[model samples]
Target: MKRLHAPAICSWGHFYIGVRNLMKNPGTGKYAASLTCTLLLAGMACVALGTFFYFYRVKPAATAGVLNNIDWGWELSYHLPYVLISMGAFSCLFSLVLRKIDFSGYERPDVWLLSLIFITLLFYSISSQIRFLDNDEYEHLHNAWMMKEHTIPFFSLHFKHSPLLEWITVFFMSLQNPSTLIIRTMRLFIFLLSCGSLCVIYLIARNVFNSYRTALVSVWIVLCNFVWMEKSPEIRPDNLMVFFCLLAFLALIRFHETQRSRYIFLFVLGSLLSFLGKQNAAIFIFSIGLVVFRHVLGSLRTRRFGIILITTGITITALAVLMIPHDIILDIGFKHLIPNDNKFWPTRFLYKILEKNPEIFLLFVAQIFLFKKIKTSHPIFKEYILSVSIVALAFLFLMNRPWMQEMIVMTVFMTLLAADALSRLFRKTGVIICTLILLAMAIPANRRLIKKYIVKKTMTRDLITTETILKISGKNDLVFDSYGKPIFRHHPLEPRYLMYFPEKFSRLELLEKSRTKFLIKDSYYPRLPQKTIHWFENNFRKTKKDPNIYVRDMAGRK
Candidate 1:
């Protein structure tokens, strides 16, 4: 690893030379512009590091000793304005830097651009330290906690989501020290996957578009998106799935360039890994065939077309039979959510993207009227088009419900289109115009990023209730969370997912049969049935003076 990274290391001397070169080649005001840009980037880097330290100052232990008591609302309201003003200042400054910097002397994968990505991601992910787990995360983490005994994930994060993520969680959990907080290590895992995803996004962009600036812009566009920023650090299965899908996409793009059998093997490996991560990742398998379809069409009567179609068909079948035969529910859903929203139809989909994800949407629209000329026969052009087509069509045709984080799978294609547009725009108007356009795009994205990923505080109620549960309950205390969550090491009143299907077994019966030490609703757990609420009213009283908590009454229970 050291040998591989040796050539790309960014030394201070390199920057000094870069600066000295700027000073020497100045027409008039270039030196001052370069110095100011340097100062602003440095200042932003310090703020990012300082913010991370400020939140994580109190180190996490076995208990949640790291959490703070600051009102999340107060924190956001107090600092958000200052954050935005500062972001705008640096964004404009960096745009000037891009406009004036002599990047001609720098080589591919510019060290400065790479450093910017690393710093921004490092800052962006620190929010995971304070961010509360959503209700789905509670379920997902519970399954992960149960990984020691149950590796199958019979009723998983979404009841039917794949088990690879839970398996990986088990490996992380196994490696954690008993003295340290397991969740903190899990946070590190999520952070690593988030970083890996962005780095691959850069690689795919560079390969497809063949321009460092385009790749850099695409990475920023993806990093700044609201959904990606918000869900990037989550414990959900899709988080891992997104990383694998990008690998498959990049591998297939590589294969298209050099019909190597190794790339095909890589494509298969990535597709299988992603499929095991989440079923939705089958979109990538479909995309692979479409992206390589042109190559197959020429030999439609020959073995080539047969090979591609047969490979795709076999892959889909293998993934389906991997678990679907054993769990038929994997291929079916309970129709939990009906699409009554504005996006129920295909026609309104782009319009919704326009409203909710305006930055990528606009850039993609601009890509249609590219600012520079390109040959239609180019391999990159064809790969880009087919990929965009297959991915967009898959979303429209297959999604039972498509919005928010579901679009994470489509980010690569959207960013690719955006990068192509920026490349064309830069060709016509130079780095100044492209830089201005990028900052303009990231403004709204950063607005969402600040509100959702940075300043915004969430999961306060869960944090309070969880801490209280840990304090009041014994190691063997039986827990009954309607949401099927695990409270650290507490005993569960019944099989966790039994609550997921209330009709199969009466929760009241389970409660009566077990010790039923405590119940934690925590605001967002599913509401109890009327009879169960009545049963709880009779047998339990609030523990820790928290209304959301219910502990057994000794007088009644004994």
Candidate 2:
């Protein structure tokens, strides 16, 4: 046992205390390093929690099959509160992480704003499902099924054009069953793609504006809209194409910065993918051409111009040859929409775009000022501004018509621009004050969308009918929906190709051999053929109606 003097013991104890003190009060360098670590941990925690909640609660509940015996109307009623709570929690966590982030020399406000926009977009795209409660979405699904089952889209929304959308549908159907709910869930993939594209947008805006606020403003413009958020989950190829177009735009901007062949290749590939995704994607090509003409022409002297022109011409030739194969062109008539359908399909070019999306035109007028501000920092934004402006103006001027179908795209752009405008206003002023203003506008908009679509129309009634039909008819058997109602025709039955063509098939044979049921379209029996009506009257017995769908047993046995 080594014995120490009291003085030696006391000196050793002091040394230990000093070491503890140094560890506790480690200087500014240590403080910053600690702060960074804390922020990282907090961000990770929030993300983990969000993922847990999303998988366990949001995704499952939102994508829950209609067959579940829950009151979907009531369940849907909880969506807003649920989303708000999750978003609020995420915001708080993210904000805390922001606090620890050392803005330091990289005080690029664009970085911060872009981050916020990116997160906002991710939130909506991830959380929301498609708002395609209407018949059009079903039509898209029908096209997808046809693609999967080896059928083709005959007409509508590029209808009667090559079965292009079939390829998109098949892509989705391959991932999951051909259930409407599953199709809706696939929107998450689009949402994720949109987020990835926003990264490019952020980079472009950051370089152009050199201001985080400007970059963020562009992002804000993309988010905070019912149009994009509500429709994120739709099975439409438009959303997918939009994200791809954004990616192409980003690549173009990168090419401007780096002047690299690789980026140009990316730009071309992305643009081509966008073009192939939907008809509107062709517009993106025109916009890209306009941007190229603006930039490349400015720097070209006689010699440079010749070289650039030659290179451009060769590129164009190659792309054209690649895209427009001779056989494919012959198979797909190069002529504009089926001849002599002017009543349903107008040939007036401007009228076609305008008529399909008049609101887009109005939104352009409204967003003009914001575009002006954005152009101050980014000259390229002017090209997009001009492109969209020219398209809208030309459509209005030429056809003097409205493009009602284009509302979805127009609304998406408008809402994005509006959100940006609003975000800028808030940043310039304060969030507390701006939020009140947004609320004032939001209330009316919410009421209009909810009352007009979600409430008064009562579209989910169709879901109930489908469920009832499946229950009565059994999942294994083929059933005829006699409920000749347009909703039935427009929705569940229409897409499934389950509608009975009166003259083509033997109804008696179908009913007697397989356990099939006739779902009377009690609402629209007037439109049903007399032969179909007589057959239903003779063979089936009406089982029930109200609080449930009416089912009739074939052969008059019931």
Model 2 Cα lDDT, one tens digit per residue, 326-424? 655434432332233322322353354445334334555666755666533446655664574355334422322223333334444343344444445
Stretches of candidate 2 above 4 Å error? 1-132, 150-184, 187-207, 222-233, 294-381, 392-459, 474-476, 479-558
Reference-based TM-score of each model? 0.71, 0.58
Q: Candidate 1 on 329-370: residue-level lDDT in tens?
A: 434332322353433544465565567667676776666565
Candidate 1 residues lying further than 4 Å off, grouped into runs, are: 1-119, 151-159, 177-180, 301-353, 365-381, 388-393, 401-403, 484-487, 490-506, 545-547, 555-558
* Every candidate's lDDT: 0.59, 0.47
Please report the candidate that would top TM-score against the real structure.
1
On the 0 to 100 scale, the lDDT of residue 183 in model 2 is: 38
